[model samples]
Target: MKYLLKGAGLALLLGTTAAYANDGLMAEIAKPEQWAIPTGDYANTRYSTLDQINRDNVKDLRVAWTFSTGVLRGHEGSPLVIGDIMYVHTPFPNNVMALDLNNDGKILWRYEPQQDPNVIAVMCCDTVNRGLSYADGMIILPQADTTVVALDAQTGEVKWSTKIGDPAIGETLTMATMPVKDKVMVGISGGEYGVRGRVTALNLADGSEAWKAYSTGPDDEMLVDPENTMVLGKPIGADSSLNSWEGDQWKIGGGSIWGWFSYDPDLNLMYYGTGNPSTWNPSQRPGDNKWSMTIMARDVDTGMAKWFYQMTPHDEWDYDGVNENILTNQEIDGVERKLLTHFDRNGLAYTMDRETGELLVAEKFDPAVNWTTGVDMDPNSETYGRPAVVAEYSTAQNGEDENTTGICPAALGTKDMQPAAYSPKTNTFYVPTNHVCMDYEPFRVAYTAGQPYVGATLSMYPAPDSHGGMGNFIAWDNVEGKIKWSLPEQFSVWSGALATAGDIVFYGTLEGYLKAIDADSGEELYKFKTPSGIIGNVMTYQHGGKQYIGILSGVGGWAGIGLAAGLTNPNEGLGAVGGYASLSDYTELGGQLTVFELPGEPAAN
Candidate 1:
């Protein structure tokens, strides 16, 4: 049942009692009738328990209501449904609207921030805000200009606003704020602008600076306890990050954490991955570029590293390690283990022991991936936990100015910022993936402040000799490290996915089709084309005793950048244009929310 708070109870829930607030938010998250957090819950599962619109009836779903954000660009995140109110956010200027579900989606209030337009120039991809976070009766927004603001959920009044990064130096914010305990955590963007990346925590109560941790730098600055922080279950001695880079290159290292965040409350650890290092021309700065392409498990309260796992050391494919980590528990080898499953940009699906940072399963989610032979799984091998790089596709080994062709997954990886969903009922993950490959050539480049520092040029196309399509939506069995079933799409599945207890999985496509499929069979159940292409995540919630599904339809992200930004060059948009150029022929630019539900009277709760 939906838990509606009001008056003194609502006040108590939003009070300064951190424990009570956490408990209250956790309670709300458990309801399944509300989208309290962007990732649905702290685990970032994106799974809903509400099954009112099951596979048997999902075909009858129709549009119940729609709201336009009045802004055009790539919409990367989903709206949050808290109780009777729906909070919607937009890109670039980052306007937020609060809608009352009881009154035909009436606007309760709107909060629009005036951000500098120049900030868009420094953003690597399209200017996309990943949506908002709600906590302690406040809606948290991480603006593109690096300012984080908290607004009153009821009145839409600014509670507190603070600038965390300097846009003049190429630091910006594109991720949604993750509120855990009494802290609101946010990460920086601009990996393509030679900006050093970091994640910062702000006081949830007052927006005051709490703690900051750099992704690449000295151990002290990174808040890494060399003696205590374990990597592959072994202590990483002092200067682990410093010794991995040449000279002071780590200062401009690009380990941006612009993706999603997941937390394990019991372990008190927040999990997130870092992006690739600066200067895609890998030969410029050597060593493993420690921590740049690593998965980090840090104490949520102190922002100190507890464990680390580097996925792609010295990344040469621009394969960012910043994909969302889905935290789940699965039976592996007759033992119930806490598993962290990630569909990495490098075309590998990883299932690791979330508690100890132990590698459990690593396999290619896409057959087209050929950059690595496979991850060395032997514990005794020197390359244990590392990908056995294929010399034929290693851009670094080919050196600068030489094109590395037929690299599967491209710089966009198998998946970009689009998030995958986990269904506990099926023990399967529904992933939105790209089936594209690239020809990458690295070249020397000089970094100028707030200017693009990308040192590589790439052109992408569909994975040859395959489906000839650009994307796939697949059901993955993490326990087996394999795809249970796969569904091909004409373009990359750039939108996030949602799995429901109803045995239905939903994801959007670059052609604006919001599709529902059978969770077990991967059979397409229903599809509705929205006003524009969908790069936004799919979300669900129940209101007035009725279940509803929602998605933001816009056409600008890395994949849709060619159309969204009016760029016609095939090489533009960081090689995304070449692969997704046809997207414009299918859908145009739009910024609106299309909500779907069954046509009938309110169902009994």
Candidate 2:
């Protein structure tokens, strides 16, 4: 079952300890002057240590520079700053631009890949590329056509290009590539198209296959040691996935990995969550649909699963578990634990022991979540760690063609792919959330390659009987499983959040305003309108002794699909268009990066 790389020099490459490469990357991340990775650091904290613009002076922040990607689609991830250069990416065609920071943001080189336009049809949501990765003088770009290309950082010359998946059969790549010690990891998209999802690792030197792990399949194909890989501290045994499905239906079972990934060098394990199962109709695929909506921890060297925990089994609401996993250390009940905190789309915030995969705390982060009463935490109960389903909101219980109404948080959940930020300064997590509800009807459908296999029709709107707002920005205390403060918004905060040592937190709205708030109190400090609505992540870096805050404004994620793709139907975008139809009234289509800084002279290096 060992999947070793094929090339001759791969032995030497694999011989290099992960600690050596991790140490080099860790040193780069230690420097506050550069954003070396997409999620700020491997923990996916999205936090910065810069304090050049403090809360007292943040009101005077102004635009220092702006650059357009010229694609005019949804931008989901932030740019990477390495030394004196910044790497920017675009959607669809997947263009990469390297800007010279020593100059006035002049473009040093650009790499554009020619992809088939038909690939756009298979994409479930808007055509968005999360971002890029840099390692060993190479810039890694995962294209929408399922190609992973490695470019020379300086000249933008193609070093190697590898095809990971086939777009003709409903496979694409949207998540940002992760390059570890000796491999570049990429995940496949298209859960709505009944695509069997997987994660593949390629040799960093020559792009040879290192190992591939499927989400649902035989234990050997999944790289899971049935008796060794623990789930909730219990072994899963054998055929855990095959036994859960009805016959060959598991072949197209969708458990996509199109989300954020985090790694712990000490454990040498990488963590990520899987998406929902295919054919949204719950009755179509019986049993628990094992491993579909689960959080997985795997060894980076061999693609072997160490542990897993299913957050929402046999999902009926399309609530994807593919959100980011934030790794941190905290004390709970007088015990210090290596914790992994995840705010799942199922409307629950989970805190677990990262080493042994033990569930610790599970609580509702949003007040409007009503699909389930809460997660069962009783250790002695047979339903331990499972959600207590409220039959009134169960689409499956209502049966096919019956509209199950008033489901809170909708299918988009409280939060989509837009990530949250953790600030050690306040010991809190700053989350951007959606306040919405939906009515869903499930039906039976036949599966077809490259065509959507979704069998659900839904309509979404703002949550009723509350603030009337569609979104909220809250400060969550994971240790206490409570929200300290919440700020309501007229629209969903579709952008990724950034926490700084300056006691400031930043997030963008679907109305194009990038607002800065007090990290501890959730008080608004400053706000500025960009060219378009923002669905991108916020980033910060220092160059020439000047700190700058940057965000991409394009407005085409699942939250802004009504305007991004010009869909006018209420059932489109999986009910997101109907929920956020008002987004077009505030902003239009555009793609640009707006960077901010305090008005002052640069300090000496």
Clashing pairs in 2: none
Q: How far in Å is the alpha carbon of 550 misplaced in model 1?
A: 0.6
lDDT (Cα, 0-100) at 343 in candidate 1:
91
Candidate 1 lDDT score at position 284: 87
What TM-score does candidate 1 reach?
A: 0.96
Number of residue pairs clashing in candidate 1, backbone atoms closer than 3 angstroms, sequence gap of 3 or more or interchain: 1
What's the residue-level lDDT of 279 in candidate 2? Answer: 79
Candidate-wise lDDT, in order: 0.89, 0.88
Off by over 4 Å in 1: 1-21
Q: Tens digit of lDDT per residue, candidate 2, span 8-91?
A: 100111123445455555666667889988988888888888998889889999999999998987988999999999999998
lDDT of 1 at 541: 95
Model 1, residue 520: C-alpha shift (Å): 0.8
